[model samples]
Target chain A: MVTAVRAWPRPAGRAPAVLGILCTAVGAAFVASLAVGAFPIGIGRIVEILADMAVPGNASGSFDQDAAVLLSIRLPRAVLAVCTGAGLGMAGAVMQGLFRNPLADPAVIGVSSGAALGAAIAIVGVSLLPTAFRVAGGFLLPGAAFTSAVITTALVYRAGRQDGASGMHSMLLAGIAFNAIAFAGVGTLSFIASDEQLRNLSFWSLGSLGQASRDLVMTSSIAAAVGALLLWRLAPALNALALGAAEAAHLGVDVRGLERRAVLLVALVVGALVAATGVISFVGLVAPHIVRLACGPDHRIVLPGAALFGAALMLAADAVARTVAAPAELPVGVLTTAVGAPFFLGLLLRARRASGL
Target chain B: MRGVLLAACLTLAVTHASAAPPARVVSVGGAVTEMVYALGAGTALVGADSTSIHPSEAGRLPRVGYMRQLSAEGVLSLKPALVLATAEAGPPAVLEQIRGAGVRLERLHVRHSPEAVRENIRTIADALGRGTAGDALLQRFDADWRATRTRIAGLPTRPRVLFVMAHGGAPMVGGRDTAADAMLELAGAANAASGITGYKPLTAEAALAAAPDVILVTDQALEAGGIDALLQRPGLALTPAGRAKRVATMDAVLLLGFGPRLPQAVDELATKVRAW
Candidate 1:
């Protein structure tokens, strides 16, 4: 059904304007995210509270609950949401470009499942680990997830290589196979886990931005920013990649080198983001498609456009997650799908109608 | 063990602190909330996590989400003076954020033992400045516990009890180290599935092999699938308990909550098993 709307008109000249509008939408969503939560602080009060933090010696001379909530809880969470969404969106775009398939997303490379298996192991085996590892405590799940994602990516890349040359079909097949294996590993771990540990695993798998902290936001922001920037710079090569690998090679693009860098960069960005937030489904898969359907197949525009749209989408979804249920929050991953799917479907319908399909 | 020591030391630390007792409290664990109510400090509870379902009044309080997946803003919205949580309540980062926001958070150690329950009661009582009430409640609990133990000790034999929780998929049997197992032991009964380390799905062979005299089921599980349906499962019908139709059902929270109601739960189970 989606394939019926595949032929979008190439409006290359409007790229800069679309990117600008997307950037502004992301900014507005970030502000809205901070303004809404279980705690109700008016927009004016939110501005004043944030502005006070910027100034020196502005303690209101009393315990400020609003300021405490706005600063410690909402601010870091919003920042982390933006960083994570940006990373996932950019990685999705790169994967689609590298694979030459519009449906491909970051998960196609085995990141999500690999992370799932790693986190499952950490949850089920934490008690048996030595004190040194046990003492790491809070970092254990995320660290294991990130490490395994990298390992799985490396394995996928190595297995897909034939006599010093990388093949896209082989790589895709390897990823699908690894995903199945990883899922089975997770199932086995679930079978052995204690009740509390099983609850933790389910919560982790459902994803949430509620765990955002200053340290996590700082590190993930840097990683996402670096990865996004590097990928953005490679846009031209990626566009060349769209003309088929053999054709791109004849035109002076090093197909194998580009593929290696793309895979590595996506793994780094996606691994960090997913490790922090758990498995946030739909964003990576849907964000790029929405961008391409709106604009064109040009990677230069699609890459940045998807990242901005993804950031906005996550910010809006997370805000709803924390507010819709009041004090009892829904998982953000659930909200993302609930929010993204209908909106994505609407866009597809419009695309089909416009194409006379 | 470290968590137990930490909770013990924190209890002492709270005892020494002379700060005014909190007027607004948020409780994150089910057991912690029960203790708060038992100490007559329920009036101070402005919010509680989803697990806090007992006392009926706790259900009316604003919910701050599940203990493990807490939202800092949700808890802070109540503007609580103090937050009482089990050591298990956390994604870890949210707890740190709540602390950073200047809320006093006390994490009580929870284990499936009467002593752990007593420690929690003491910790909550001290934190709420209800030490006199705590002492009276402890005395009453000891009396009930001693009486129950004496009654159980006079029994001719300890029944091999199986705990089957069947909310979804295959029914899982509680084994050694589980709260269900500990509760059975406290009730002067042997755990049928003690050979397994924790909870494991009941295979027909394993269920037949266990051959428990009495089966205990959570009220929630019983509600999901009736007692007849449960007994009719694969190898369950072949078990001694199933053939005899001897099943005991109790609220999971009451039997496993490990709070102020621990003695009452033990007394109830001991009575039921002794009668059989």
Candidate 2:
């Protein structure tokens, strides 16, 4: 049935041009994010500062902390927003293509829940370790999150495989099962968590780019970039798999290998995102679906378009998060969902009408 | 010519802005607000965070919600000239944004001690241009501190006290370097949970292993199960505190704020511990 849909003719080249336009628009949103911030810095001042940063800062400082805030806080936050959005979007697009199911999100395969459980354990369980052994900072949370995502993905893939063929239905069901188990794990951590740990868990669960440090932003962005690019490169293979796994195998695609790679890539990208921003839901689901509807079901266009749109949407949401409260922030994760879900439902209705569903 | 004109305008604006220290202050952390009141400049405060629940009037001040969860717009609505916050008083981006809004953001270190309290009073007072008031508060606090030291020096035995943050089956117990730990140490009492540093949720068996002679809690914790029920809880029932009904409650702010009234708080707790 999925292959039947794949045989539906798509106008080539036109989609890529549309995708290029989308990227430029997303790039514009990224610049807009850089311009607006809680800081009293104007667009004029921001332009001067960004230019100044390149010119060795006029050799010695024009006000230190203000410059530090721009360099350290706002820049990284905007960058991370774009990178994390791209990562999640590409991962979602890849997952949907691999599963040949419009409903598949990067998290639907249990990787995100597993990542949350991993983070919960790091935040809560670290207290149990001797102080000397527990290393703190940017690495531990993401490391644990990524590790758990990989482990969970491997588990789901193994479970989904029967008679040397991976079943998308089985993979999704396995994801559901793993997600439940991960929830129980998180529950156990919460049960034993300290007041501080509980606070950490609560804020982290909401997720934000508010904690975007330069190093964290750089590392997460790189990981996300790599994951998105790898998945984007695998676009043709994903497109092949959409023709049903067995039929794709007959068409010279390595069905079993492609499944493993896709899941691994999703885990790496989405897990890094969850680690950084703490489970930003709906962007992955909504971004790619919007792209698919706009550009048709061509994997090549859907893949890159979703990534760009995701970045732009995340940046816009983050801007609202920063300024809506002025001196306080809404977690970007909450804003994305609150804003994205309605638009998504509307788009879904539109898609249903277009497809005569 | 255009560039030079822009520079002149920029410098003039920057100079004028820096010349005036803010008269309208927003205090973000509990301890920082307490110090502002202690410095006798409470009138300067237009707003404070939810954590600033000291001196009854502070509760009446417009709140910015929890210190960790400040709303940027809510805080900005008060139009504070200076926002005094602790190191932990943020979602960093919000604070950064607040700083960017041309507000003087004074973020003080939240050390858990009487010295930190004194320093906080002095710093905030200095900011408010009330150095004389800060000096007077410091001297009086010093005298009280010396008296407490003398009383604590004469103590024959330091009973082990465990500071449990909550009583209704909470796993968390306060350990070293916390305000509770400092209070016990200053009051001539040993913290039973010293083996583990910071607040942690040890297992019921592990918590009982600390073998506390008394359990210290804030009145806020009573909301969970009340003193009677808290005393009867599983791990708590095995402690010497449970056996003798030696659980003592104090105001959370008074116990942990580490503010201007800390020396008095220390004396009161020290006396209670001695009597126990």
What number of clashing residue pairs does each candidate have, in the order they appear? 0, 9
- Supply DockQ values for each candidate: 0.59, 0.20
Q: What is the TM-score of chain B in candidate 1?
A: 0.91
Error of 1 at A26 (Å): 0.5
Point out the worst 10-residue segment of candidate 2 chain B by lDDT.
B12-21
Best-matching candidate per TM-score: 1
Clash total of candidate 2 = 9
Evaluated at residue A313, the lDDT of candidate 1 is: 93
Name the candidate that leads on DockQ: 1
What TM-score goes with each of the models? 0.93, 0.73
Query: Per-residue lDDT for B21-119 in model 2, tens only?
Result: 345789988888888888766766778988898988799777676788775545765767789998777666567666765678888878877777777
